[model samples]
Target: MNPARAPQSVPARLAQIALYGVAAAAVAGLVALIVSAVLNGSLTRSGTADALGWGALILGFLSGAVAYSQSGQSRIESTMRARLGEGYRAPGLPWPQILAPLIGAGILSAIVFALN
Candidate 1:
């Protein structure tokens, strides 16, 4: 070992997150394809109900998060930032802003993931 060896670079915990995110997304997509194929047969009605239930659970939690809002420009921002990372200003009317992104994304997801 050299006495003048360069210092080692510290690893960021988030570095593997993006790769895993992509991989998980790909896996989810493939599973969705399989589920639709199954839904076309015996699981059709029940599967649709399950999907709607999942949507409701997800949307309700998301709405609650929005309602909670951020502590905005406060002392706890550092704590919140550590937990959720940075926040950005969303430019739009409150109601429409709340509804639009989720709805648009849902619509696009549904179209791409149409069962029939």
Candidate 2:
């Protein structure tokens, strides 16, 4: 039962991942609103939705990429440590966390399309 093998506590992990998704969504939504306003010279419902959806999708994909890169980095570090006979422990990839933003993006996109 290596500590590194065990994933983080469920509730804590969920909260952290959820926060990340929500923050990303909010930031993306704001950016989209600004861009829509600038391009259209005013705010429109469809425009807002489209902008938010695009923002969320782009940021979500970026977040997933970053998570993947981090996972790869961890694995590499672990391998290096093992080869060096060091006692460094690398955390396992948190798949649920990594997928959270992507899931949020999909849901947001669906809602946007439905509205439009």
Candidate 3:
């Protein structure tokens, strides 16, 4: 067995891909928000309101991602049992560590959105 090439199950691979994708998206969104804030210097109430709306959406994604990370393995197991019947086993992602930044972002974004 090549230690460098541990075979991952499809579900595990999918979970990894999903986490990476969401992380990328969150970073991109944060960058865009920063750029928007910098470009729109003199922010009116309406302008800040737009940021609040964006914050809400970002918060939603982060919250869901955090929730998913916390329960995704069990959810996957349950779904597999329901669909494939018992004894179907598969690898699960290390979600809590993977989703830490998203969790932090969710908390911070919620605070900012609330303040705005």
Candidate 4:
């Protein structure tokens, strides 16, 4: 095995991908809802609900992914470096460093999108 590549079980990789998928879906759904609301001039209630829903969903997913990734013997940093290449850091609190900003940015974007 390559030194740069860490050995991971198939199930683990699948789970990671699934987590990403869920996050993406949550973000996408929120965007769709916001767009619909904007088009229909219902931004007040619908936008707030969509933003809150997306934020909660994203936070939950981040927490779960961090927990799951950190459950094994290997630390998240090492796994991320191996999988994502060098300079990878797990996100703060409950996220794998690298994913923290991405997740935050996505949620923020959703909020802005809804507001606009």
Candidate 5:
């Protein structure tokens, strides 16, 4: 298997992230549309808000899954490198992994409050 290469540059990393983000947003939008239709039989304000909250929840769940996957990969990589006599330092906590869910939850809460 190939090793995980570092990102080529900061801009490249950002662009990659941006692409994933756009895809996520598209998925969330589709979800919201379906939810709104089911919950209200049309896209009303309340339905839209509720659907958005659901979307936020979904995004948070997805973010957590991604974080877990990345953490597992890092652990495996670190272990393999250590076994090969390369120095292995403990990976620092990933801030994006930690923060994304919190932010999503906050958005969800705000939307819920606004709707009520």
Candidate 6:
């Protein structure tokens, strides 16, 4: 049995693709939000608003990514456990680590948008 040629299971491949898709969605959503803010003039010419908007966009994306990652991991773990007839525990992302930064960025972006 060649380790390199080991057959990959469909469920594992699907789980991996789902994780990647979630990450791509998060990044795309962030970019879209930032672009929309800029186009709507919600960000000012001083660059401060732009920075704030970007910050918020990134924070929100991170938050969402962490959440989705954990959810996907849980689903994968559950499916694997069920198939293998064993208990599984998947580690979740550290959401608290990004919460404060996200809240601050959100507030800053709101203020900037309000002033614009």
Worst 10 residues of 1 by lDDT: 12-21
Instruction: lDDT winner between 2 and 4, please give it.
Output: 2
TM-score winner: 2
Candidate 4: Cα lDDT at 4: 57
For model 2, the stretches where C-alpha displacement exceeds 4 angstroms are: 1-16, 86-89, 95-100
What is the C-alpha lDDT profile of model 2 across 1-116, one tens digit per residue?
99778888889887877777776667777887898899999987888787878887786777679787988899889889999999877886667666666656765677687778
Per-residue CA lDDT of model 1 for 32-80, tens digit only, reads 4466557676446446545443443454455446544633344355556
Score candidate 3 by TM-score against the native. 0.37
Clashing pairs in 2: none
Residue 38 displacement in candidate 5 (angstroms)? 8.0
Can you give the lDDT of residue 81 in candidate 4? 78
Write the residue-wise lDDT of candidate 4 on 1-116 in tens digits.
78659877887865675567456646655675676577767756656656556664655566567666665435656686787767654543543443543555466556656665
Scored against the true structure, residue 22 in model 6 reaches a CA lDDT of 50
Each prediction's TM-score against the native? 0.31, 0.65, 0.37, 0.34, 0.56, 0.48
After superposing candidate 6, which stretches have Cα over 4 Å from the reference? 1-45, 87-98
Candidate with more favorable, higher TM-score: 2 or 6? 2
How does each model score on lDDT? Answer: 0.46, 0.77, 0.60, 0.59, 0.69, 0.62
Q: Candidate 4: where is the Cα deviation over 4 Å?
A: 1-4, 43-116
**Runs in model 1 lying further than 4 Å from the true structure:** 1-42, 71-93, 101-116
Better candidate by TM-score, 1 or 3 = 3
Query: Model 4 compared with the native: what TM-score?
Result: 0.34
TM-score ranking, high to low: 2, 5, 6, 3, 4, 1
lDDT per residue (tens digit) for residues 20-112 in model 6: 545444454356457766777674455555555665667677767778878888898889888999977776665454354455455656656
Best by lDDT: 2
